[model samples]
Target: MKDYDDTTWFLGQWGRFQQTVFFLLCASVFPNGFGAFSLVYLTDIPSHSCLVPDVNLTQDWHKAIIPIKVVNGKQEWSSCSRYRLDVVRNLSALAYVPGRDVNLTDLELEACVDGWTYSRDVYQSTVVSEFDLVCSDQWKQPFTSTVYFLGVLVGSFFSGQLSDEFGRKPIFFGTMAVQTVFTFVAIFSPSWTVFCILLFISGLGQISNYISAFVLGTEILTGNVRVLFSSLGVCLAFAFGYMMLPLFAYFLRDWRSLLLALSLPGLLYLPLWWFIPESPRWLLSQGRVREAEAILREAARKNKLQAPQIIFDNYHVDADETEKQPKEHLSIFHLLKTRNIRNTTVILCMVWFTLSTGYFGLSLNTSRLHANPYISCFISAAVEVPAYISSWLALRYLPRRISVICILLLGGVSLYFIQLVPQSLSELSVALEMLGKYGLTTGTALMFVYTAELYPTVLRNTATGTCTTVSRVGSCIAPFLLQLSTYLKYLPYITLGTLAVASAFATLFLPESFGRPLPQTIQQMYRRESSLKCPFITRKKPSKAVVLSESKL
Candidate 1:
């Protein structure tokens, strides 16, 4: 029997049909680029000080109202504390010069009683400024990002099962609508609590649609076209969207307006429904052979070629034999049923967790860079372009395991070196950080492609979603990881770098999927010889049933 790829070979790769699906699917993910990281600007904390109420005071007294404290070595005005207003007023009446006549340190300090005043140099308004989520409430800011990732975590758990059960196209578009609508509604959120609720809902849609689109595209396209779409095409579209976020935020400068701008673009994607089609492979897996054939025929029509009268003549449907077996609902647990897949799942989970920790940790840290947040964010997003291009090259030419291991090591090493640079060469520090981001970005892109290929169609989305679900745990903690830098400079880098290097070493245990046909069933999953050669484990020969199944494929 011919495999799906062999059966579809007549359609040709890189034709008009493949290009259309590639671009449209890539376009579908464009909004996800900006939507994922809009929190950087939405909750941005700008230069600020305690708001002083109107009172009779000298110029020096007004300046004296804000207490100065040493940060990193340089004296800077305290953002949360201020001189007691009553003391400042009395000092002003005494004609006391803050530095000349009286020592400012003698004055008592108090928390901002009235409110806070933020400089509009960077952001005109943000959640941080509007809600005063600073000082005592400062923890809310990072918690907000954590809430969003929690939503992503929950969404990842169900997206694969839902897609596998219902179909990819509906879940893809349905979740896109969920993300768009909730984001639009969030712009009008009256309080942080309300905004967080909406953000959580939006997150549920965000990652679901992202994974759905990824699986949908991978299943629809074949061979190297699949490689390009997975590695460069979809990722670059997302990076472009991310790149555009800072530009929009730079002009808007208000959290609500930036969110509005981000949410509205998703509406443009609704038209894509007609242009992109469902995965024919997924359709066949569900026993909808005719529907799958219909989609392939439409693709052939778009490619301006005539599909054969009977498309699935020599193709075998795995579902056909199990039609009367009560239709078992496959889940993530199925990935653990066998040793080969169980090992793959365990290693993939580790790789994904570490990758997410490094990638999102660096991405969210962009706002804290010693430069304009907008430019820093743009640079961060822009760096992914080349990284993804490099990923495409690596995915095309190198073995999957080597590519992942090498890029992960690059990220780990670059991040580890950032602590060696002096403060005077801050530019070099930023450069090394970007290089770390570059390496991680490339690894991330490759992992997306690599993970999808590791599992058979029956468990592809579930396995991918499971891996990404685990990754969200890393993302969830990434905000708190950034906070560690304040207590011990470079602590986050050291931690993330160590994990990256460890994940690199772990990659050696998984089988390489390079230049091999995607496995269509659990029986056909690629197994590495080294796994069997482990010193502590007993090697077993393949069962007759497994060998017979492989022979049939």
Candidate 2:
């Protein structure tokens, strides 16, 4: 019954930094995903910032120092004029100056001659209107926006096996480093199509790295602390990440600049090579005893405790002592053949799919709700802040099933409410719709934690990948489904709500896994999955590391 010090326990285990990794990882994607996505609309803000250096005047000194006198003939170096210089230094200050006295650059002076001045006009007057995605082909827009999630689907399948065979730490860093490169490339794409293609590449890295990060988290730490660091930590990283987009956009304007600003931080993780340790569980799985022993010894040293006389490297867990379970191999296909894990997978997948669609659908639909679209969108997202705390509390008391069911049901009902409400109330209607949006967001957090817990260790990441992939399928469909709502009225929300309900109900069959040992195989998941009411994880007093030939290991 030995445990490491609470402070140094998770602190030593590489997984403790999962939140750090997730926050960093999420930071890497947001500039492109949230930044680029939000920037398409906000990009014009910088063009506003790119105004003439000195054109801000409201008062009039005299009638004749007009823009024509400033940089009229200086079209070649128009931005270098005295007016431009003054404007750059004191834009707001010039507002008090006489209008006639204020000078403008060549283009500005030309627009000013007839008092037909249009401020902030470099991109195009029609630029904002281009959003009339009504007629314009969005072939690349939809793909670029979601290609990362799709890449997750693909990466999850292979990353799990890679993590299994190659080890978590390497794949984790490898994928992230590669992802960082693509993320940079994604930022520079000339068009949305290229951006999306690059993001697709980065997405592969994002999902696989995520699995490895979690592998690190689960390998180290024990007790409630382990649970907290692994689950709530990731949940918070996403919540905080969503919250920061507007802030990042506010400070950094150029979409490309913003993307680079966000991505360059990932380079910070490269130095993490020396700090984080390889997963002890993964090490044990590979029968790398000497390595696992070294890691365990370090864990003991960090916590100032002695390593157990003999570290049990075998898959056998003694229920009498540690309540550990016997290991079983669970293949991806075998997940479907098994009843409980299969059931959990289906329900989790549905829940994941519905939430991804609903969350993105609402994000896409904000403009449909108001006059000041960005303002409305900002407030709508603000409401999700409380859900993360509520979800954390809910996880503490309620089981994942109840939490998920309630959240998804809430989402379903909320979506229904969105269409049911009259559009006349305007802002209030958007807020109501956002209630469901927040629910879907919360449901998504629940799914990430709940799904990762269902399978045995070997298949966990693979299972997580499967869940991630299925959800991306839902995300891929959301743009079309959400846009279709304009023609069909309540169809998209209603369809997503129905799916949420089905996903919620699927939880009924899954054994609530809270406060149980993480299952490591399909057989363990089925016949005797319950830790609350189980027979024995081990029959003997956990013998020495069981030697396994290549056939066994």
Candidate 3:
């Protein structure tokens, strides 16, 4: 019997019906993009120093309380320490001058026992300011982002099975609501602990909605539209949302207000519940024949076409003859059932982990860039446009393995060289960092497409979800990785760069999947072989005769 793709040709592939679903689903992804990285602005460390007590003192005496220390070769007031209050009080009692009689350096220093003053120049309010998550609590700042990603990891793990068991539409709408409601609630969190808890829950919902929408689009659309929607539609919309985030943060400097602004947009997506249909493929897999038929009929009617009167007629006919055949329900463990499949799964996991690490690490590091954080973040988001376009075009033309390796290597090399850039030329360093991000974004786009092509349909979702879970492990640690700079300044970059390059080599071991049809069974996946000559640097095209022979097989 013909597959669903063949059977559904009459429903109109790229018609108005499919286009509506594609764009609306893509719209759902926009908020996720912003939400995923909002922590960057939310947790940003504004200029701060220990709050000096309000006392009538000379200008010189005022300066003495917050002593200047040379940091990174630049003299700046100490943020975590201040002159001992006893010494300052004694000097004031004596009515002595600050520099003439008193040696400020010789005086003991102490932590900000009273409170800290914050600079409102860049941000009106941030989590750092609201909770005083600086100095002793500075570690908590990056921990918040880590907690969010841990939630994403949990979401990715269960989203597939839950959607597969329930239905894509319900899971999609439910997760979207959870993400929106929790995010808004987080704004009112009374403590950092509460905010982190809400943030983690929001993450679970965020990834669930994202992956569900993605799967729904792929199942509903056909041919090039599926590729476009997955690679360009949702991906581009995500980039657009990311770009909009810095703009929103730039205008709304208060973190609570910015979060409110981000969460409020979910109201626009509520209408999609009425419009986006359940995935007919998923419905059929669940043996919900009537539901699948109804959706197909609606799709045909909207596209101004006619579906087969008996939608399941062919499926029933095929099932009747194959009644004696045992149906296989593959799980994640099935991925390691064979040597080749197990190897592919391991390599893909490494690739995914490295890709996610580099992507989030560079993205979160925008504040470290020399330029204004808003512009730096905007540039980071903007660079994805060309990077994604390059990825989309490369997937259409170039060999998949070659594209993955080249971009990974490029990103890895650039990240390593970023250490060589002199701090004096901050612009040059920022440029190299953005360039590395470009490569990382391209690799991210390519890996999703390549993984889909690599696995058999029987275990594709299982494999993909598993890889995504592994990637989130990297994402969870990414913020902590940034915190490592406290121990050694370039540790984060060196770590991510090394992983990217190592994963590039790992990509070389995986089979080339360009221009290949997806396998439908574990047997087919095992029997598959690399068609590309070198599977490394070479990109020779197969002859027409060879292509025809392979198709005949």
Candidate 4:
């Protein structure tokens, strides 16, 4: 609510620099967090097919009907299991394994496959028509990637609190340094278990870096710009995240090398810290009005403008211990207890869970030594851009509920078609993913921006963080659900699609939140909804000439 229009420094070049650095800094998340998430598409899983052979299984020994176990994407157990069965067939076709070990292979090795396969999603996939790698059953995939997401969930939940308490710049730099250090440890871990453990821990650090970028970005802009571009920042980062995905997969060549390549972005961002300024908004919020004033003066000095006469303490920040002793007590825990808040959380979480599972589910499965993993990744990422553009349009022009409903519906129906599509037009398989991507991406972005807008600023950070946490709970399950259905890929998509639609419909009960100032309480939100639909109520303005005549009700 504080206006910096009087602050002469924010009016020119410094403002532009601040906005530019904010975006570039957030771009680091792509190479750090998302690169790990997309590792499934890039990692090579040992695969074999009962139906086809792309490599010479006989070079090692004569094989026919080789059950090749191909590790497509990150090496998880579900992928391993499918790869193991397929590998054995191809191994047997070239030269069979001892007959007795087949049972042992299935039993003793199931754990290994599970280790490689258990993603956060529930459904799973294996080599069927497209993917055809035939080689060593051993594939290197880091389980630490899941741990990284767990870390992200935690870091994102608390970044606002920590950055506000500490300083935005410190948390940002510290977390990036941590990411660099742990990434090196993971790259050189002697054992896979040790590596995964470190990877999980690294995620906690990497996630906070993303949060710092968001907070800093918001603080740098005016209200009108903040509403549009802050949301645009996420879209840009994600779009670039998806675009970088295929590029990384194409270059890194191996999981370790790929990870090492991903870590280099930290170094790219580290140099930026020197030029980046502390958030003036956060400085005021933390009661460091003097420092806020100094920073504003610095920005003005950099822009060659004089500081305005405005005092540093002029802006009122509603947060912190003194002014907020009791008023800050919207009670973060209370959000869970209220029926409306609870409903909003559940609906949002369901959408996030389904979108990730459906989108990542299909795309990840189709990567790694397919007819073309690069082509597949490119197509899927390409489809999602439209989703982002569509969302930006929806936010710009349409009502919240209707716009959300349309995308969710498109995504849901498209999912069902995946079950019936002809593989000959095989590209359509990935094309359908757009439906889910468009819906889920739009919903998630909208939910984050809208959730903050719905709650009072006192608990705005808490509400958005809590909502993201619920979505993370869903993310924790996406890997498992995604891999569970290797034998039946369509089932998971269908179920996820349905859940997305249902969540969209559920959202209808919540009122629209466009152009209105955020409500100070859940009670305020409800009262406003009621006022809009007040029955038998009409107001007529008396003509200008009759303004002097007062009416008594």
- Regarding TM-score, does 1 or 4 come out ahead? 1
The 10-residue segment of model 2 with minimum total lDDT is: 542-551
Q: Can you give the TM-score per candidate against the true fold?
A: 0.94, 0.71, 0.91, 0.72
Q: Residue 211 CA error for candidate 4 (Å)? A: 2.7
Q: How close is candidate 1 to the true structure, as a TM-score?
A: 0.94
Show model 4 residue runs off by greater than 4 Å: 1-18, 32-34, 41-43, 48-145, 303-306, 311-331, 337-347, 366-370, 422-425, 486-489, 517-553
Report, for every candidate in turn, its global Cα lDDT versus the true structure: 0.87, 0.57, 0.82, 0.56
Off by over 4 Å in 1: 317-326, 526-553
Better of 3 and 4 by TM-score: 3
lDDT (C-alpha) at residue 348 in model 4: 57
lDDT of 3 by residue, 1-553 (tens): 1267767789767888998999999999999888999999999888899988887666777777998989878999889999888778778878888878887778899999988999999999999899999999988988989999999998888776676567778989998998999999999999999999999999988878887887788778877787788778888999999999999998999999999999998878898888999988766655566888898999889988878888767763234222312233456776776555777999999999999998999999887774589987988899999998898888888988889999999999988998898878878878888889999999988887788768754455667777888999999998888878879887888988999899988888788877665554444455464342443466456456544433322
Candidate 2 runs further than 4 Å off? 1-134, 191-193, 313-331, 368-381, 529-553
Ranking by lDDT: 1, 3, 2, 4
Tell me, what's the RMSD of every candidate?
2.7, 12.0, 4.8, 9.4
The true-versus-predicted C-alpha distance at residue 470 of model 2, in Å, is 0.6
Better of 3 and 4 by lDDT: 3
Maximum-lDDT candidate? 1
| Model 1, global lDDT | 0.87
TM-score of 3: 0.91
lDDT of 4 by residue, 12-108 (tens): 6336454565566556556544444555643344332223334455442223122234354433223322334455545557555445434434422
